[model samples]
Target: MEETRVLLRNKDVANMVDVAVSMEHGGYVGLRNALLMDGAQVIETLRDSGLRGRGGAGFPTWMKIKFAYDAGGTSKVVVCNADEGEPGTSKDRILLSTDPHSIFEGMAIVGKAIGAGRGFIYLRAEYSYLFPILENALDSARKSGILGKNILGSDFSFDIEMRSGAGAYVCGEETALFESIEGKRGEPRTRPPYPGTYGLFGLPTVLNNVETLANIGPIFANGVDWFRSIGSENSPGTKLFTVTGNVHRRGVFEFPMGTNLKDIIYEVCGGIAGGKELLAVQTGGASGAIIRPSQIDIPLDIDHVASSGGRLGCGTIFVIDDSNCVLDIVKNTLEFFTNESCGKCIPCREGGVQLLKLIKKISEGRGSVIDIDTMMDLSNTMRETALCGLGHSTPVPVLTSIANFRDSYDRHLDKDPCSKCSPERGLK
Candidate 1:
């Protein structure tokens, strides 16, 4: 019924000074104290909290742990999936920059839960700025006996190491992430042998997104009902959304899961810039579909977005104003996919470039009526034939654009003899 209490305050500012001060003043003391109790107690507290993965998937965090623990064996490992390469997304970056300790605490809790002696955070190399901050936090945690051998003076010893990724977008995939960490070329592996079953040097491993682990502290401090009460029946607790584009108040907003998109765009984000009419919204990053103006009233949550033909992916809300040409956006997004594709799959690597070529021709006024049909067919091929989710879900934006804004595409096809496409005409 009410909003969840803010656990990650002071995230916007680059004030690691305050974070360091907080950790020194017993910031993760609640979790450190909990490690004194049995590990099952911690898992029970997490289950009660009903915390779901903040990554696009929205899987339950506690259930992931239960699976890892039940798959009984030695050489169990825990990994923090900090490879946040999703375009139009920066929530995980903020978490790492402002509150790295929360992530560290969560990793330790996870290690304790699954009988893992070691944990590694597979972070992206782009944020080279935060490496020192993370190192400092780890050192501070170790000095206080919260991390390292005999954590909190108990036999349960847990330590976390930071490993920066090589900045490949495909590495964001769970299997690819494991492969990258193992010193292999960054590429995705086939599923069925899920990370829960066999991961990180052939052992049962648990991997969680940065924000999902960041919520672990509060789950222990507060009850599950308290967390569940903040959001809808299905999607509970607060989520961090990276709101950008031509908007008046463009930044991140932490709101309950089921908040209405219209309210967020108009009220929370201070409406579109210059009072421009809202064209559509890209709910997820590059991998998500676009929501037209007619669908603005939909709730902003995983199930709600999915039912409405969208995904509440990695929590990015890029508002598209009417003045911007839909074709131009398509070109920009296609170029991103073209460059980011790992070439492991033919459909994504080749098909993404081919899609860009078609869009480039259309944007330059050399497109045809048949190009539309060709684009649709290629999208279907990529979706069905691709090996991993990256290649499979890449066509969502273009397909959704065609479905919602067909007239825009039609305009490009039936253009009059004008400077809009003439050699003399300057690109808009």
Candidate 2:
């Protein structure tokens, strides 16, 4: 399968981060073109391009912008979610490091489209190393008259500031991110007045992930048809997937939305590490459902992956090889959500802890059929009652692993455990 290099096109270009170099290679053309058109026209073009939110939710980008625009208020804001905290997801970090200017340009375009004069980049603390690079990029953009009041001699004015998160995985949720930016404890606000109507200091705000915003520059640079021509009808254009765990070539790879999972694993990533047999893959991230070996041919689009009970979350493809135990992986994944739970909601707080304990019991060969049943029930409860996506989606790996590999769990309950999972044995 051939890879499309839209976001990663200038990755290998020398001095790619330099503002002059970026401008020479069609950097701010989208913003410049967008500024010339009416805000509604830009939104219409995005809608036609079939550009959905790249931040796992798969919401239409134009709808979000239009909502903020229609909400009708002053002090509207545009936020670029750069807090790439999901495990195995590094596409945003790479984009911010390599093409910071493009993101700034995208945010500016979004600001102009939504009638927002202020914007923010909510950066994750883990990627603190890229702080200076982004700061330098912002400085360059401001000096070039791309940011600040009266950008490029236009009536519109927009400027962006960067904020660092204090390492909370749940903060990846937009509302929680807004709270963190406000210097409060990071916790998700109940929705009803969604972010478009009321967000960030109680004003209308348009929030999009780094990758989603980055796509704006190109969508406007080339016509909407150009973007729609690359991928499937439902999910047009290329998406960056961060492939890791047991893959021979583990890094960010850009491919069309409907690219085959086999192509990504075998063709693009050079197959499993050490040529080992693939046991399963967790598409999206830790919260995403597990994909069995039989389902490796499924398309990687949002709708297609959802049909298979998975999500294209943050585009993190975590591969598991035959040498590893699925139960162990589930346990680790649940443990992460357990520790990261904000304790704001009882469902997530208690449910995550209970799930972790159950997985620990099962992994230690003390589980029974009843324990498995209990896990399913608890997962349902969490999914139904949890306040935010963190708790609601935390049981995905556990449920999918059990559904696809029940024998692995059953073996742990047997009097004579399988040699592969025996106490004397350890992961290879």
Candidate 3:
């Protein structure tokens, strides 16, 4: 119902901007506790904590660590995926801005977990403005003995470096991010050798999302049960959701996993803007599934959303109201995907163009039910066979829009009279 802040707990600590000030308020305590344990024990504590990745997919944090840990590369690395490029998702940026040390500490703990001496943060170009804040945090941590040579009086020496993205949305994908960091054109690499096995600079790397890494510090600072006690049985810990669109209070919220989407819209975000009726809510961002008002009652967790044929990807919740046509909004969304597509693969390269054209036809009153079916086929093809997640997720909105707003698409069968988007008339 309300924010159950964990990574955001630094907000309650005064002057958390300074690393020394942050330490006084219990920052880096996790890394300190983690350093006391061997690498295996550090990971075992994480396993007991029940932490999952906060970035879209919700993979288990401990398992991913174990993969790279067991890979036993001579030169292992830890990467913080700060490339928060998904539309309407700024939760990672919030953690980076408010309590950067937590992020730094988390990376360091992961570094120790995998016996990595160096860490890298692939920062989103849009978030380049936060560069100095991040630099200051790293510098402060280095000086405070929280990072760098023999951290916290242990042999686990770890330091973090930050890299700026080239404003490519595809770079948010782990492999693409690795390619960009290694001085290559940002494009998705084929799988089989996932990032954990072969990552940045050809080293076995444990790559984690910004929000996912942020949870690491608190997991060790507090006990396993403490973190596990917060959220659902399977989906433990809190989730940071960025609410936008027709919501009156549009911002990031940290609710326990499995928080109700309806409460988030009505109680947490003050419902739809004005008194307009809620038409749809798109979770996971522009690339997320579109949900009808009835489905908004679903829990905002990994398993629940997936079981309900949706995803809590990146945990961005976008609400739509009666004043806007669903076709109009989905067309705008497709335009973004089409423009941002890397064009490396056929499905995303060509399919996205076709999707845009079809959605535009419907938006401009020139589409048919046949067009809807065609778009679904094209989108599904991209999802199943595309090179990376960019193509995979790009179809989610188009497919879900057609599913939940079939009546809206049916209205545009031969002609669309929904241009003005008046609350009472258009697409209602």
Candidate 4:
């Protein structure tokens, strides 16, 4: 199916980087509309819209605004999480590099709604090339009277600053992003003081990723009813999927929420790269569930993926063909998490290395059946006890691969292995 473009807009328009081009296409319409409503009214409008965060969390957008709004602080903050660090995910970068004005507009609207005076866009270090593009967009917006003091000539004054991360994957986590923005080491913080109540500089903050913020401009531009009518009942509005890995057409595509995974793979992605037999599919991120082909028919929405034992996190899809072994693929995922772990907590710091060791053992044709069972036990413990999502979710791919593709693991137990199982090129 063709992309149902709502968020990805006006690629054909010349000089899209210029504010005038964005204005030509009804840009800042949402901010103009939002500025008219009271903070509580804005929150209620979002509630009626049924918008959830496009980030991995799948949290209700309205609720986040309400939390920061109801936190009842004069000095609140709005954060745009542009740190798109998840493996196989590039949707945020696509939005920021192409449609940057909308992001700034969204942040300004949130600042007005929550009574925030200043906002920050935490751009990932890997995306430093985008800094100038974003800055150019910001300068254009400010000059056009869309940002800076008294936006659009209103008394409400708000401005946004851009911050760059230092290439830490853990900074993708909300709290870690805040820490990095504060000139500290990027590491996840303890809960009970969530971003809504106690956030950046100890101010009540509303934090949403780039795609989630981008949706705000469109939702108000076209009525909320239009957004709600497009996607599933629970998950309203279009979703951005970054399709990569062994696909004939690998890029960002937008589809309504609840689009069938089978259709996404077979049609949207143009089947596998070379008509190869599809072996497995990994959704969400590197640590997302390893879904078997038989399970691909299910809807690709937050609730559906959760109910079906997967995560629709960041809307990334990694397509694996028959040539690669599941064990090797999972080993690579574990290795990434092992390297990315902040080492602040014991379970994740120690468990990652231990999990990597076990996967290496199993992939090298050195394991018995007991090793499989042992890995599961260790993964469960980490999931339940880890300090944050990094530790909790690190084991998802391993556990999901074990549950869905047990035969792959069993094959490694045999002395004679298939061509797909190679120990030398364990992880790439």
Distance from true position, residue 274, model 2, in Å?
Answer: 2.5
lDDT of 1 by residue, 8-76 (tens): 564644544344565654467657656766767777877777788988888888888887787868668
lDDT for model 1, on a 0 to 1 scale?
0.80
Off by over 4 Å in 4: 414-418, 425-428
Please provide, for model 2 over 166-249, each residue's C-alpha lDDT reduced to its tens digit, 9 standing for 90 to 100.
799989899999999999999999997899999999899999999999999999999999999998999999999999999889
Per-model tally of clashing residue pairs:
2, 0, 1, 0
Q: What's the TM-score of every candidate structure?
A: 0.91, 0.96, 0.96, 0.97
Against the true structure, candidate 3 reaches a TM-score of: 0.96
What is residue 236's positional error in candidate 2, in angstroms? 0.5
Where does the lowest 10-residue lDDT sum fall in candidate 2? 419-428
Off by over 4 Å in 2: 416-428
lDDT of 4 by residue, 1-428 (tens): 87788888765566667888999987899999988888887888888889899989899999999889989668999999998999989999888877888899889888888999999999999999999888888888889888888889888888889999869899989998889999999999999798889999888999998999998888777878998998899999889999888888898899999999889988988898876889999999897999898999989899999999999998999999988888888888988999999999999999888888888888777788999998999999999999989999999998999999998899888455446655664332
Better of 2 and 3 by lDDT: 2
Indicate whether candidate 2 or candidate 4 has the larger TM-score. 4
Model 3 steric clash pairs: 56-314
Better of 3 and 4 by lDDT: 4
